[model samples]
Target chain A: MTVNVLLLLVIAVTFGAGITLLLERSLTRIVVGTLLVGNAVNLVFLVASGAAGRAPIVDPDDPSPMSDPLPQALVLTAIVITLGVAGFLLAMAYRSQQLQGDDEVQDDIEDTLIMALAERDEASQSWEDDTGGEPDEEGADR
Target chain B: MTTHSAMSFLIPLPVVLSLLGAGICLALGHNARAQRVVGIVTLSVVVAIAAVLLAGAYRDGPQVVHVGGWPARLGIVLVADSLSALLLLTSAIVTLCVLVYSVGQGIVEFGPDTPLSVFYPTFLVLSAGVSNAFLSGDLFNLYVGFEVLLAASYVLITLGGTGPRVRAGSTYVVVSVLSSVVFLVALAGVYAATGTVNMADLSEKLQAVPSDVRTVLQLLLLTAFCIKAAVFPLSAWLPDSYPTAPAPVTAVFAGLLTKVGVYAIIRVQTILFPENHLTTLLLWGAAATMVIGILGAVAQSDIKRMLSFTLISHIGFMIFGIALASHLGLASAIFYTVHHITIQTTLFLVAGLIEIRGGSTALERLGGLAKAAPFLALMFFLPAMNLAGIPPLSGYFGKVGLAEAGIAAGGWLAYLVVAASIVTSLLTLYAIAKTWNRAFWRPPDPETAPPIGDWHPSTPETPQPTGDWPPSRSSPTGTKSGEPWAPTLTAVRQLPAAMVGPTVALVALSTAITLVAGPLFGIASRAATELGERTPYVTAVLEDGSGITR
Candidate 1:
């Protein structure tokens, strides 16, 4: 395969996975998506290092091959780091689900703000909404 | 044979010690007491190593060591110059204080068992990461160092997995991940353009690149760093996220994380891409960060949240020093960074103590603390003054040096910095005053107070749900009593000695820095010179001539 074609395929798959993950509400799916994106980036890096080259190992007996060793080394480090990070992310996701009773992350700030505003509006209307001769003390307390 | 070669071996000692310490911490994970001891002993060793490195740098210029006998271009390199040594030393000192403080606070905050056991190892790993970032010579290695620390930080920040903390942690995680991605993308672009990840090699190669391409590289790198540093438009996540962490975690994050970002910018400017258009961009960003950050501080009613905003604002001052691209400016920035780290952490510790003694961190719920706890008041006051750039304080010296450097840089940009510094300092003072009034000076309202029992004069009546004051046990009638309040004062006069000791020590250290500003500034100036001159760093790594063909 041509280097350009392989590079384009890597990019397409990577972005496809990323977009899929972005649309999902499940934390596990999002983590998987992140992993896919990471792999795609690693692939992009490999291609950038000149894809046509042979492996970087030096063998005097074989003279025709030349692979760029630097990208491979870089990719190795990136892969290890990505694995560690992904593990941590999964652990966090598991913990979050256990604690919050849901797999979907809460947009707590937005939800709280909406709830607060609704409460305030309810509070303002409480005095005017009373149609009876006298409001019950317990009902008026809120 | 050269001084640089001898210096290189000594420089990595601290990092190695920290890593070893981290391993020991993990090994002793089942025993909390042993882990604490190991942590303290390991950090003490780090402090010693930092002192040695500083002395060596002072005596023998910059030192560079290539890992595993590889050449500079192909191998990972570690450089310990004046700038790195200074930062390493600051990290050691601040971490030591926080560790001590945590010994007392951690038990209360995290319950003495499993949580703290996890916390110790992670904290050490974070320290190791900071040490690595300071010492690393390869761009890729720098990236690794950043990730090491950042990953640890994510766990620490979200330590308890509480609802508010998790919500905050998610924002922090997403923003941090996005920033890391930007950094990775920039690194990829730089490697593609230069074909080498070695910083010294890239420095020489980057000059040959087209100006426009270089500009793009600069922006990409700086954007990532600015986000990490919590600069202006990029800093929105900080106030929301930072206040949710435990006190020690927040203090360490406030002191160390953004400084690492600043450190990266300083390193890149001096070593790789000196004299670029990025300085102008940094200048504008610094001004915006200072103004916007302090304005955010003004709007906060929570002590820790307000402190978080000020933390972001002060980062602008550090960036301003670097943006000047002059020796004086960079030196002052270094000085300011060191000073700010100590003062900022101390302030957070005091605020944390206030929260422990008083029920809440909110301004509305806390009051008359100065009367209730004199020692806490004193501890909070000194750092507050220092943070506000009061005369005879280390903060003043740092601000003065930065402003002088700014003027010396000589342009409209310099004027903008001066104005921003003035405005930020004044606003910082205003914010601190607000905290003082609400948290210390004002009387606790009866309706909002935590329930109080057996009211002693020393114990400000913890507020009850009712709008009436709790009756004084000494007074039969519910009227005011004439008995002395001295016993109350005696009872609440001191926090546990362990908590009090670290703050007092930090405050004294800050004061000492101010008193010896001349010698400190001289050292900072030398560090700046060593940084600006990249030849020593490059030569140290490449001098063996065993690796590179060219």
Candidate 2:
């Protein structure tokens, strides 16, 4: 199964850029990242089919060693799915923007709550904090 | 010949009926009554169809159907082996119960003024996707099934488009998309290496692929599923996102979605990559997931959030069973998946009831639920105890099965995970007990007493004082978590019979799993045995006769 280096490079670059974008806080950039990654994966199907040949239409008389049609068919399905997901993601991004005036993902409230609880525990248990959250009553010792 | 045609007809009905039901529900959105009827009827029919298919698979062999009259090599196949049938039945039952609960609670209903008339259709669509995933014999079809369910879940998660929901939904959507993309890449790699995505074909074809490429494919596939299944490191998104959705949506997702991921893992490990080179790796993942996930559970102050962590923790048990890679291991894993699905969903539904009764799920804001509503408390108690794997329950049996498998496998890693699983179970009990004591057993906070009979639209309108429920007791500035901080409402009236009925039914079903644990485990072992054999599945799909050339 011979493969082209150029196609490989395209997949590599596109996937790399997409992943970098995906690490951002903003939902718009994440959507762009997802779209880019999706396209790169579609190209993966192409590369997987090896060096491209004639369009995959079966004909007895016109046998020109066509590329595997399966990957192409699969790519079509993948494209439609990606487009649908991208549309839904864009809608969500718009909604998030409307709700809070930005599309950046918020920190998990549960995590924040748990961290606060841990800090509160640390404060109460620590010997350094003589006040222990009651400054007037306990700080006189200090 | 008749039976063959019959199998084909029965195989597609679950997905087809649900989709048709969704379309009808959409068309009848203006008529909520008609829409509800269509949805309920459609799901009820599906449940029956699934049961019939399960009976057939158990009695006969794996039932294989090629869609659109295309032969196995060229077209999609839906195979109802024992495993798929069992899951199909369990999922069908759960989805229907959740729908009934949602309808009774009016959780998924969009009113005349509400712009989104999507709830019924989306719910049905979600069920359709679940059925499709369980039944799909082709890998790409499996992917499509995942997309369908995920797309529906995106709508359900943020149904109201509130600030918190949208925020949660954003994270969920992004994470799920990333996982799907990974799955697609793996699929591309798989096709590049082997020519087919059909599971049966892959079972044979994958053996010829180079070991390194196979390992890479295996890792990518596992990573994709791990994100979906919420295994340890990939699990941070779940507890963060799940508790934000409305209870019914969250319930259904907790019940069915991750199990689908686990099911996929079972398929990949047993069928595609039977060599099981990743046992140590998966065992480590299982141990870490159980310990870390439950630690997070123990740290949570909210009931729903606590359950979310427990859900993640328990996925570890199933993964452990898979890592064992024996008949007992696979059987126990399948059995455990079934048990967890029913118990987890039931617990979430009970959480919803508690929310309605107590007006908040936050432990600080809730107390005396047992005194206020003994029925609701009972509903919560059974599943909560069962989820914690108390003896004489289905959860306990499933755990015992896993521990036995672990002992039989007899590796240091297996022993470690088994110990970790027991500890995880205890931590789960601790979390559930804390929730029980704080939210149910303790007397209502002073601020909540002299209870006003407030009418919450989320519940049936109660006869009482029209005043605002309580005077503000917390700071004037609200917290970002949206937790009330102050005392919410105390239950002074009965929940609607409609709402209570479905929940009772679900609780009863969970209890029924215990009553029939012997037989269900029998079926699960049978399913696992069939899976172990492998030939039944491959031959059923491939040797259908009149098959197209590979």
Candidate 3:
């Protein structure tokens, strides 16, 4: 089995772009990234199937050259899985947009506090909020 | 059950039974009682089967069942080793308890045909997924198992489709989807490097592969599992997402889910990558995960969020045991895994009771629970102390076992890890004590007492005429405080026996673990020994020359 440089380059570029999109703040970009990464993974499986030749059919006497069927099966399963998760991600993004007018996940209050403390390099302090303990009404409304 | 005939049938029974139960429960969605019965009965049967499988595997070594009567390495196989059987049993018990707890919560449907009606079925499917992952004999099959459970979890996590749940669900889904993608990529890499995805075959082939490639493959698999496991660095998503769900949902997720990832890591590290190339990395990661996780726990004012953080921290202890790569270490890890699962689930269940009784799990809004419901306080206290590694409890035993293993390893890093684990344990005690002081022991001050009607079903709109505190459920919404803490007892009396029963039973179960620590540790040691040896599993699955297909 020989590695195909052209397919390798394509797979690398696709993965890189997909990861970059995943890191972006926009939910739409993340969804797109997921799809791209999904496709790139499929490509990796395809490349792993060895140099493409025949449709992987089993026959006793007619064996000239046939591609490995396992990677194709793996790719097919991956595609289906990606589709399932991608559809869910898209629906989530759409719902967020409809409700909040933006598709970004706001960091939790505690998460923000942790980040601030880390940046400040402060010792662990009591985080007891004195705002009279009620659930975050703003969060509940949103 | 000791015979091969019984073993084979029992080995796959839990997964198959759970899936069938899920299907049946889904079909009976409109009838809530029927759904509840199906879920409970199915889980109980699974628990029984798991117990038998555990005993059987212990007696006869690993048991394998091939699907469709196909030969091994070609068809999906489910193997019930002592380790898997132990995991299956623990998970089944936790799932059953949580199911009862959810049933007690009164099965509120958000709409006529909402997903809440399907919660029973989804929960069963999640259990099936977990069982499948534990029993799977192949990497690809394990991935399938992970997806199965994950899909069910996605449905369960967003059961009410409330605003907070949906938001949390979205973050959870995105993170989970990314991890699955990474897992797929890793599977491809494994198959590419070693021509098979069947774990038994790969374990043999992987040994012959080059060192660098093997390390990469191992690390890739570890990354996927780590994200699922919520180890530090990849653990940011856990605390944010776990707290918003309904009580039973959160409880089950806390107990059984991350342990599945830890199980997978133990599987790969012991059976496949026996060379221990990444022990140092694992140790460092464990230390950070423990320390950082506990710090996050200490920082949280909310009970559920704090438990979630501690959950991550304790996972570090398990990783430490696995890192040692010794018989005693793995055994201790196994024991600790079982102990933590029970303690964590029990703690969360108690927290749920707190939410039910006190109207909130936020420590700032909660007080005087010990006076209101001493039973609930006692339930919380046992698991809380156990989790903090208090002596004479299972948690103490597990921690001692881990520390002994660390000292036996006799390295500076190991010593550092031991010291960190001890500190984390003490800090965990401090965190739990702080929670107890605020939520239970302290008297409810009239000035700061949470207003009434926060949880009363009659008034979804904020309470009326509660003096100074804001009527808004959100604290910042109102500029006041009042005398509502007195009426909390009325809600406490309304607590359903069904909800309280399951929690009491689970706490009793954890106490039973402590009582029977001797025999339990023996089982853990045997399982760890068998896992360390590795050949028993290879032989059990690949007997009769059912080696690599390629």
* Chain A TM per candidate, in order of listing: 0.69, 0.81, 0.79
lDDT of each: 0.76, 0.83, 0.82
Q: Which candidate number would show the highest DockQ if scored against the true structure?
A: 2
Task: Please give the lDDT score at residue B375 for candidate 3.
Answer: 79
| Per-residue accuracy of model 2 over B452-479 as CA lDDT, tens digit each | 2232332222211221111111111212
Which of the predicted structures, 1 or 2, would earn the higher DockQ when compared with the native? 2
Give the higher-DockQ candidate: 2 or 3. 2
Query: How far off is residue B512 in model 3, in Å?
Result: 0.9
lDDT per residue as tens, model 1, B278-327: 67778888899999999878766678888999999999999999999788
- What are the per-residue Cα lDDT tens digits for candidate 3 across B400-426? 999999999999999999999999998
Model 1: CAPRI class: incorrect
Model 3, A28-64: lDDT tens per residue? Answer: 8888998999999899888767778778898789868
Candidate 2 to native Cα RMSD, angstroms: 6.2
- Candidate 1 C-alpha error for residue B517, in Å: 1.7
Give per-model TM-scores: 0.87, 0.91, 0.91
Ranking under DockQ, best-scoring first?
2, 3, 1
Native-to-model Cα distance after best TM-score fit, residue B241 in candidate 1, in Å: 1.7
Model 2 agreement with the true structure over A14-80: per-residue lDDT tens digits: 9999999999999999999999999999999988877677888888999678878889988999899
Q: By the lDDT metric, which is better: model 2 or model 3? A: 2
lDDT score, residue B108, model 3?
Answer: 23
On lDDT, the leading prediction is 2
